[model samples]
Target chain A: MRRLRLVIPAALALAAALALPAGAPAPAEARVGGRPPPFVLPAAAGGPTSAPFRMGDHLGQRPVAILFWATWCQPCQQELPFYESLYQRYREQGLRVVAISMDSQATIMRAGPNARRLNVTFDVVTDVDTRVTTQLNPRRAAPFSIWVDRAGRIVREQEGFSPAEQNAVAQGIAELVGR
Target chain B: MDLRRERRGAPRRRLAAPALLALVVLGASAARAQSDLSFELPGVGRTTFSLTSTTTLRYRGENYDANRFDDDFGSLYQRFDVALQADELRAEARIDLFVPHTVLVESRCVGRPLGVDDPSCYLDWDLRPERLTLRWEPSEWVVEAGDTQLVLGRGVALAFRKVDLLAVDNALRGGHVRYQGSNFRFGAHGGLANPQNIDPIDLRIVREPQDVVVGGNMAVVAPAPLGVTLGVHALRVGFEDVDSIDGVTRSRFTDRAVDVAGWSAEAAGLADGQLALYFEANGLRRTQRLVDQARSETGRGVYASAQLQLTELTILVEWKDYTNFLVAPETTEANARRIYSAAPPVEYDGPQRLRGIGNQRGGAIRMDYAFLPGPWSFSVNSALYAFNEEPHRDPFEGVLVSHSWMTLAKRQEYGGDLNWSLDLQGGARFETLLHDHDARFRSGDIDRWMIHGRLDITVGSGDHAFDFIVDHRHEREIRGDVAEFQIGGASVTYTFGIPFTLTLSLRWTDYQPGVVVSRGRREYNFLGGEFYPSLEVRWTFEPGTYLSLFAGQTPGGQLCSGGVCRDVPTFEGFQLTFVGRL
Candidate 1:
């Protein structure tokens, strides 16, 4: 009887929850205000010797904004200038912008030309196997932004890009960089 | 916000009784503080014992194999997980219960616990304690034991890993310890391998031959503008001898054993964004015991990858060679993250190739053209590898006969992909991959090509959304390697504002034998390939508390995750899964 008492209401609540129609809420980022997720991606050519690099290297040096994007994303292209502007203003403030491309090999090089055209100055690490994306974006969607403070904590995460989202993300970057 | 705190911490106190009792038995220090338990159990019927259950009650309309006399009964399986944490000490445990309506007396077993000799010889329920772990952190030293995964350096040397989707429950029954500092991290682990009870091999790994693995790794992170790091890792495994004969002995038995070890060094650095360069090299040695004596062999492999961002495009080139590089039988390097695994197609070719990775050398090139950074883009990647040594097998039966430990000669695969993704409120993507491969014998000459494509589209507003996916694959193989086969599936998913989701999926398969028995003669079947359909509904009643019900038959095909790939038998029936953490 006691077990029934607990099970009945709980079942009713769950059933009611499940009965709701589709259009689920926006999914949440797993790394918000938490320890940075583990990741390793291919570094771009030149600066450092070619090797597998991870998230720990940026700690204590400066704030880092990891923009997971692909050239094909319209919003990503629109947002590239935003990141460029931010990087330009904050570069001397120890702010680093790393645009990790989730593009196919054929399209990844395209980021190079776009960066030049957009006058975007940032690092573009390539993820071939999608390992890092799998961890950070479980849904496999990109144009996602993650802000990591100098303390190595992932302080903010914004997915996709809307004008409102753009402002919030810019503010998030400003706060993290100022910190 | 306070409710969130309550949910994370409330379950901790309620579930502390039994876990604490177990911890006490393990000599846990009482002075340690406990952390909040944030896991919430999922179920329609809930309880607060910090207990959660995932129940899958399956009903197969028809027995999978008609030749079998025993009826396939409704199977009900429930898995219960428990977790507890105190300050720097933590413990987790999971147990599974299975009850089937009918058990075949003559049948071996479809599902059984780790040590059950006859899981289905008679009708009875089953109880399996699958995993248990206890960890304690004191000051800068961390010690842990029981069912743990270890990743050393680039995983070229050590990575005992598993994937749930692939039905790979492999783990190490041991412990790992790590010491952390401002600029460096190092760790070591030692454990005995756990063989899968339901390995596709169709035979139980009789305990006579178990493998033990031990390894360690260290890494140091450098400062940026150009951040660079270097690391080294190593691991060794000793395989216990296996007795080939069964228990109903009247036969002579030969015990086979091998000792394998690997060492790797990796260097990775980045220049904020200009370019990234990475390189890794691994050396391996193995000793196998023959009928009378033991013989040894040595091999090494190096991997170097570079990404060059030129204007609007990025180009990547990678190279690798691992001839006869062998790890313990239980540690398959197929999972995607391992360095030693290398790219597909370029594998190690060794004299003692069994069922895992070894012996090949090759390089690959990939180019990306997203410079327009538009929704329309594509990539091309090609890889080729050559077997340095061909594994030798007995010509009569084609088995590794008479102590000849040789891996197969290799093959090659090169492919290109076109990718497109769009997001309004929901996300959509379409990708197609075309590739060819060689699956020949020692010469590695036989070849064929295949095409695979997938499209995911989501359309709707915030109130309700519709997600659809269409995918298909066609493969052409050498000889009867696969003849000609095609597979495709479609899924429709509806999501209701943040908490509710329903999905329906259907799949189709077409298989035609391509092999010629006598001379260009083919095998024909009057019956065609079948369709598999399934429906699932999920509800997140509360943060971590939720319920899911699945019905129908999932299609049978390759199930690959984390580089480990395998084929899973189709599952027909219903499953209800509930997870709770608090």
Candidate 2:
């Protein structure tokens, strides 16, 4: 075990010498292939509603997009509006969008008003209970977005969203749904 | 007042008989019987009233003249708090009474306790029934609509959940409802809190109260090995004229308010071998509106901690990161005081690294070991904190320090603390300020030496216990300001046949100067010592009733925990506490 530990560091050092510069640009998002875990959560802003909320439910029916957001988070405020516009543009075709809120029940009591004031029109659910989060410890952290194809498999997972990232999400959804 | 004193003293004698007889049978029985309670109320069918109150007085003072006139002078500060709750009237299915007063007394700006002939005093109080309320809890679900506390978690997110038993000062005051089940627990509370009341200045009137809503913690604890804690907190707090100082009436633009929302998830696993591992994460978002500037700022902060224990060793690590999008070009000052209450303002902007240095990165690593063979069980701990400019999310707060030792005190044991190094700091700036000519911290930049000592102390049953220590330290940073400090202290405690025990302690610090401070530097005898004699008397009048009186004096110094430390004020006074359960 000791020899292996020493060997690994030496191998890594050699690899670093051949690798790109330390300041190299971050890698572009690539096509991811894997089955997503299933989940069922309370719907957003409506009566206790549950659409086959699990990941497996949309496997063969439609292309699925899931976005994790919180009420007080500033980044989500800027990102969710963009998702809503894309959902509007593509919902009729075959794309299905699900917005998951990480806010606790206490926060939702106040954020519910803000969402209405902002005119958010989409399907939202609360992850406040940690039913789905503790299981999938996403690397990029919260405010993450994932796109799945009709075959019940994941295609992309973005840690944070910029205009470009959102556009990419829209294009991916369009391709999967339009197919 | 005299009759009330007589009534109180009368119970002391009434409770002493069964207590002494039970003590002869077993000491544990004496304490346990007094703590049992039915947790029932006398109302509804019956008619009765009860009044409960708790008072605490704490005073501390410190003095240090190592170098004179350099912000290192001795000081004194104290706080005396008194709180009372009364259940005044009860009839039918309800009881009505009001808590109308709270008093706090303080004495600030004392250079030293020993030199002062008299201490300055200040008082603050409030007597308002509007700040009070009434409630009824007839079952496992208690719904209280008044000033109360809701404490939960391991003190990470919702640290102070339960109302202070002594202070009775509730943090989240509003309507509180709690539900307790055999396998589950739930609580939800919402109300208005004056964050400014955290440190009330008026002492007479509550000010700057804001809107608050928090759900009590819900947790499930299995028989063993597996448990989880979950909680959600939210608040919309607005300061009353926090931004506008002119005291003018204006639009909502002049209102400074912040909406804060947070959630946390914690899980733990415990197995055999006395080992456990737990992880928790908390996230908070705060949005503030500066009415005068007509601008709103928003920020987010997150923290995560993981702790693990195996056999006799334990390790813990935590990370925190916060950023402000409202402040265009963010600096330390804006983030320190404005963004977070615990963080001190910074002078520059850098990556919130893991370690101590700014615009740099830092983190801390600790390892602990324990022994369990003889009458002694000791643990050795070492921690390292690193700083670099990495823009890391979580930053380390201070320098790296370590200690290795073994000791047996009280606990009916005998052992000795081996050689241990309290600190080994090596940053250029830190080395210069802390080691070179730093008389504020006693003697610095002196010779480094080993600390060898043994402390064997016993209580409750034993003739007498004695503890003593001697240490030597050397300095490398202060080559020109070479010096040495030899410190030694001893303590002896004696227990009497009755319910009274007395303890005596003495400490001395001797300095040997190697460098000159002035042109014609004359060696001065810097003798600092403390004589502490404490007497504790435990008097039990009857079941669930007792009075405790303890009086003593302790030396003042910079008390350090983990790798950080704050000066501990010198203390010389007596404290009497009474605890009753009925």
Candidate 3:
């Protein structure tokens, strides 16, 4: 009991000290108005040589929309087809949409079939270990999306899919690509 | 005993100081910034610090009539999760505090002489940092110390991580290292198993056992024509036998150890990127050190899956065979979270319960078809399983169980103002247990079957939405007192422009009083209640800030997430929760 009394206060003090500093450039994070952390993940099944998809390569060339989803998530099932349509409509305008499957190793094999069932044309990558997801969506919300403009700045972030927000998501991408 | 008494008396006083300190820090930080804080040091590049806070307050009134307590109690739980990152270096810490130091021991103390003086009747106030970690990642290499999550291929050998919804967090408190290469990758981790000790749902705090574990995996990927990847993994877990007598604790390190070795192979992009396949097999050996002799036991498990995609149809098939291959000791207690490894269950993710994973064999197949040019789809899934007593004697030796389900869904949008979606699903499960010696099933043998259906509809467009859900299940068990029972529930939720949401739900079950016996007294399966009603309100203050309140009764059962399952207890109370991330 005595040890706990001392340890609790010391831990709080240390945390306070860590939060006191200010005035420095922020690191990469997946949030509105922030650049997303760079990641390279293995493309699900069908890509050429199963080559990895790198976020750094598309930063300044195209407006990218990253979707974090899982095959078992019902909302994600509905959202994937909508994103596929958006990808088809905006690909010519330098709009790149990448779907990142957050499925664990046990269910990862379903990613390819699910994507194919939706007939999606965009790149589908696997984050089985969730190394990239921990930095992007720590809450692990399904059907989460982050929109990055060509200037490497996040423009919009949305969690959960709603039919109502479909228009706003499309408009956000349209504006990012200067459509 | 003295410490427990002190904790009971000084909870409020002891909590005041830390509570005040937290508020001060939060106020100061809020005044300076709304989100994460960024700063720089002399030599360390840019640094960012982020904090997330979650607080829960629960008030339990009179519970079920059969198990009512003399007094009502409340508890407050607070958690702070902080992370700091500087270039390639990162640190994380989580602090949890619980107040009042109380436990719900009425159910266990009924009809007995045990009082508050009993150690099991009360809990000690707890405030500590539950997790702390430091990590460095330079280029393709990662080196981490302290607490970390680890997983091997398919999680058949070793898998430990956090499942927040289920309140399961199992971390390794030691060191981990990994290297990521284009064609070759490998990683290794070794540490003592650190499972969460606090039971928020049950309002109890218990000491966690210490188990040492070491594991590693290596994989190689080949490109194109072959399009195959192969990997191998190995794990060893040491269980220390501990005994406490007269307040003195003694531990024996060389008591027992479990070793597992596995290999996996994957073939993808077959038939022109339309087909994918995966297979994994593992063997486990347990050695127990006795006074002068060592006893050993062996087990094995296998899992295989395949996926094929066509122009308008997709099919998936999975199979599993496990014989005495439980990674951790099997525990039936509802509040125990001792699972160290999780293997995929080759069946639909639902409430269906299997006897045990130690001796089970099953397979499942699913097919999905989509109607192009419009948003319409249909899916059907079927699975079969069997549980045996002595798998070593006969691998396939038990009653047959089967489950099948189908769903039809549609989505539509009218202009840009109105949109709606609908999903209808129906499923059934059947099981027949045969007697050990008699070829014909006896009256005592168990025969069970259940049919269930669910309907979900959502209607909304821009700033407003409404969701309706209805579920029904009917089951019949020939060997139980509750031979026939039906469970049904319905719920409606309204989302008011993304800021506020309200939900009202009601559930009922027809299981009689004889099915469940609590404290040597017969009680209804639904905790002596036929109707369970609940109301929930959620307010989103901002993107990462929210408050939610739930009041009324809930009938909890087996809850599964990420292929892991846990049995949660029913609740009849009011809970308020607040979460803020900055």
Candidate 4:
């Protein structure tokens, strides 16, 4: 049959040039537990705001973290001030660090005072309705990172945030606020 | 006004509000239940009646090339159907009665049997009704009609997402009105354009004209970028002039009264991601003693398409041009102003529209990409065409440009051909489903080289499923006319949940034959199988009924769609079907 059709496309082009193998792999690490999907934002400082911040309304209950930025994402603006220096080094070891802002309030009120001049204390939420980045994190891109656990349940989701994952999320928030 | 007392005063005015809400919910559930008198709640209304009938028996036989052991016979077909439906508020109306019979039962065991039976037995009849508009909106300014699909965007709902695939043609009538918000809406109707008749009465029901096209559609609320639409379409036509059977004059012998006048203009800032730029021009030019003489087939055309995203790719462009346009001719031109004296001058056939690209007059481009992120998608398209060539525009229009007798010529083998394509799709999922994968790759050329592939599999509680398809084709011809060929096919289908679905297909072809001593042979062998069974009933029905059986062998080809194509007559047959829904 015409020499088996000229040797089967020359043996499938030498098996696709020996499977052109090399490079481009590795990139999806951080994974601890689950339950971090709660949101309700309508506040850039206005009203509706009951989001990933309700660990029974603060009293020293700290230990949040969130982060999930975007503005056409440039690596989420070079990792938003290390989440504002990990909330000013665990704010008296309570650690809150919010920074949500998924843009669009005409681009986050023009970048929220350069993110409050990187002063870095805590409250700065505005997910302009990406439904809080797919509700806290359902693999919804954009430099994500979670960590709740003051019993809000979401002990680690992280996607682009390494410094050894910010020292394993500041050593698990100093072992859950024990300092 | 005694049309049976207005159809019995329409169920006595809907039995005066569900019989006054069934006597105030059966007198307060019979004063808070004193021993079940049957009147439950939470919502349920039942009133249905049905009657169905079907009978199909086909026998066709054929045998060609019978010599010595000359005995080949196979061809047969038959059909019978009956249906009825009734409802009372749980509204529904169906009446399908078809009596289709084509039987040449065992043509002397197999000498002739192909189409309409050479010996006689062909009966066809149809009547349908499943919805004669019975609607109720109660509030938002009222809507109460029966048997309807009277839609006019922004409200009223007889949807196809408001005119992207228009539909409204069924027969049987009703009337109603009301809507005072969302910018007012109203309706009125008679019937016969649609009352559930699935388009297909051969030759357009002997060339249209039974009149009954009274229209209504209004959505006027101008501002923020202009809008004006006014409509009127009328047809009471009955023009006949058919002859052909080699006797000529097969069309164009008139009669009158076909009215149509339309005006449409929509605007939304010309440039900058434009999205609505419309202009409509229609003229029927036939009022009283009908005088269209196909009026050189009057035509009008203007089109525009735009989509630009800028960041992260999205660009689409479109253009269209029209001409005398009035098409419908698959054989029926017995000298319509001299079609080469009633055919046969080698039958000159070319220019039907975009086939392997040639004779196109308009162009466009499209590009889309999302690239990696939630299962990738990519698209790359290119199209450019400008047609009409008779030795570069006019050599006395030699039969639409030297058609395949001069061997071929549209500027030497159909010029102006450029069709490019590229498409890629990707998918992945594993572990949570053991295995899930999707892959696609496509490439194109002006002449041809169309390839395709598919692979899927799922076992266990996934309810056993498997998929496979590999297609390869090659067609390139222009002058040197070596007529290349290569076709490969494979299809496997299986479904265990939807009652039944079994498909098996295999194809292979390698030829160069145009009969120059059978130039490089091996052209016959196309295997096939089709078995689909689905007929289960409950509530909600409309175009939903099936009984299919098929057997096949194919070597015959060429069948296109939308752009119209035909060249299919070569087969080994066995087909049985019964479908009804609504």
lDDT of 4 at B41: 30
For model 4, what is the error of residue B510's alpha carbon versus the real structure, in angstroms, after optimal superposition?
25
The better candidate by lDDT, 3 or 4, is 3
**How accurate locally, in lDDT, is each candidate?**
0.47, 0.35, 0.67, 0.32
Please rank every candidate by TM-score, starting with the best: 3, 1, 2, 4
Cα lDDT over the full model 2: 0.35
Over B277-370, each residue of candidate 2 has an lDDT whose tens digit, in order, gives 3333333333334443555545543444444544344454444343431111122222111211221111111111112222222223333333
Better candidate number, 3 or 4, judged by TM-score: 3
* Comparing 1 and 2 on lDDT, the stronger one: 1
Candidate 1 residue lDDT tens string, B1-582: 122122224355344333323322221111111232233334312111122334444554332332232234444344555544333454656665544442212223344421224322333344456557776665556677886655443344444443334444445668888775435778887877653333222211222224577777777767554456667777677655432222222112233223333333333334445465666677777665456665666666465667666544656676655555545432233322222222233211111122323554556666555434323334455544444223221111111111101111101100112112232211111111112223334332333345555565544343355666776766554444466666778888776643567889987664422111111221221122256678998765322234578887655545553234555444555666543222
Alpha-carbon runs more than 4 Å astray in model 4: A1-179, B1-151, B154-156, B159-188, B192-217, B224-367, B370-419, B423-582
Model 1 chain A, poorest ten-residue lDDT window?
Answer: A25-34
Q: Could you give the interface RMSD of candidate 4 in angstroms?
A: 35.0
TM-scores, all candidates, are 0.60, 0.42, 0.83, 0.20
Displacement of the residue B253 alpha carbon in candidate 1, Å: 9.0
Candidate 2: TM-score, chain B only:
0.50
Model 1 TM-score on chain A: 0.72
Task: Go through the candidates in order and give each one's DockQ.
Answer: 0.10, 0.01, 0.18, 0.01
lDDT tens readout by residue for model 4, A1-179? 12222322332233222221133211121222333323323223211121224323542255576777653343354345546555565677666656676653223322333233222336666654242353243224467656565644444444443222233344555665552
Candidate 3, B1-582: lDDT as tens digits = 334444444556666555745653562342124443567866767666665666666766543333333225555566776777665777777777765313222233344432235644443455677668887877778888988767787777776765655666667888999887767889999989877645545344445557789999999978777778899999998864643311124433246778999999988778877788889999989777666677788988888888776767888898988787767632221233456666777766655555555567889998988775466778899988776655454334566678999988775433457777788999999876644536555523557888999898888777677888898989887655668877789999887654567899998765544322331242333434566788999765444445679998776555565345665555667887666555
**Residue B72 of candidate 2: its Cα lDDT?**
18
